[model samples]
Target: MCEWVNRIEYSLWTQHCDEGRRFGHMTKNISECMNSILKGVRNFPVCSLVKATYGRDNSEFTVAETTLTDSFSLGSYRVSLASQTCDCGYFQALHFPCPHALACCAYSWLTWEPYVHQLYRLNSVFSVYRMGFTPPISEGFWPPYDGPTVIPVPNKRRAREGRPTSTRIRTNMDEADPNRPKRCGLCRQPGHTRRSCPQLRGAEHTRGHD
Candidate 1:
């Protein structure tokens, strides 16, 4: 029986199953592929892992011309990969590649490292720490000050403190402009307010009888 089953083709075994093609099965699991990619990275420190991932040159570069559009605003920005500039000004101002420039780099299959400022690079950060700082001298060895000592005025000191009262002097500028005309709120006419308006008085008098 085993020898006869071995003689039959594998396709003959699955001929009765109608839904076999719809299963979308893969020969290799996705997690296994990811584990293979991150094989040695598991033991790496966070910073080293990030650096390794960023510096990895496994991706193949492709030649393609493409345009990037801002989805939210539906705006087109000109990005110059060679000059490391975008029309939005963020790339130049921040010394980092902006979204538009990053999109351009991705579309062109180019590396964005060249566009980034050296100040942000790991080498620059390492260089900063390479310099040895001079040890600070003891405070007792500091030079004495010859300048006059400042004394606080007793009158200026707060007498009572909850929230300190504002000491801002009221000036003419703080008041509303006198040249501007006041309007009557009830009639929408200049000179009198709604409280003293004749129309308001008439309305009150008419409503009193009803």
Candidate 2:
């Protein structure tokens, strides 16, 4: 067991050390992260909030000169406002400005809205529901069916059994290895299960002996 455990790093086993360094929080979950991102916008209307939040200042971030005009340096990270990307990788993956990108936006006196994907915008969402779907026609006005009807064979019908079997598609995961030994539940021994265990049968027969 110790040899098996030694094969993997200790950071993977416990989240204590890695969680703080990676996410800046020891116990932060998805819900908390979302709440932090949309903090003040909850009280306002969706469209109004989007506009209002975009106009808000990010004056906390201090501007610093980098090698390139479009890029900004944040310690180990490189944020490019023109390309809409950051060295941390969250900008491209989440289709929005990451911490580094947002910092660069603040430094450049630019709004973060342009860096966000169109799919998340209120106008794109409103456009989707603009076209009204026509209501489905009633079954009474349907055309008559001239095609041959399907008929089930009487012999093909399944007979009543103790329990109805599942019709779900089977996969490779369902197959058990033939080499594995079956163990007895009561005795914790191999070869037979608890139902056919000799010790259990003897115990049942000698119930009044004690």
Candidate 3:
């Protein structure tokens, strides 16, 4: 069953899916085979995992061409140089260029940097992470104060009761007699049995009525 699923995955990746993700130039299964590559790293330490992920992303940036995929930037883009419009609707929508526009510019030898917004550049990225995070100090290093420690009042505390009852408590459902009759057997009336029926004491009722 697992092998069948793997074959399906290999087919989808190599043959490409309908959602437009394809290896445009390549006609072979990826050399490393993603499942095999990732399986080994599944149990990597947290730091190693983060490092691996960051390194993987950076490696993707080195590859000039990329397949159009949902994870890339949302929608697939149509880049046309003549009209300078991208169907992704990002270039005109934000007027701040995107990867699709950059790809087009790069293809035409027309300097992609100008189209990319300055705030999205490497300098801006470097600026954001320039300051290292301040290290956390131990709790003991926190300032000491003379204020009374906030605690529950002695009277508010629950009585340290004796050992709890070992037996389970009975609920109404458990105590109810399932054998009890729905109607009185003696009177053929609702609500009680022959033993507890008021109709069974008809002579006494007659005397009271008299």
Best by lDDT: 2
Query: What local lDDT score does residue 113 receive in model 1, on the 0 to 100 scale?
Result: 86
As for candidate 2, its clashing pairs are none
**Candidate 3 lDDT tens digits, 1-210:** 778777775545555552535534244456545544456576988787677766765665533433222113324667654344578777766766567877655544466556555787889899988889999999999999899988999766666788744468878877767786587777888777888888668867898999
Q: What is the Cα-based lDDT of residue 107 in candidate 3? A: 47
Q: TM-scores across all candidates? A: 0.35, 0.35, 0.27
Residue 90 in model 1: lDDT:
96
Candidate 3 residue 174 C-alpha distance from true site, Å = 23
Clashing pairs in 3: none
TM-score pick, better of 2 and 3: 2
Encode model 1's per-residue lDDT on 1-210: one tens digit a residue.
989987876544543442554233343466775556567896888887676655442231124223232221215777776666677999889999999877767666668888899999998899988999999999999999799998999878886759886789999888998798999877999988989999999999999999
C-alpha lDDT of residue 51 in model 2: 66
lDDT of 2 by residue, 47-137 (tens): 9667654544232222323324677778899888777788899998899999888877776677889889999999999999999999989
Error of 1 at 21 (Å): 36
Cα TM-score of candidate 1: 0.35
Task: Give the top-scoring candidate (TM-score).
Answer: 1
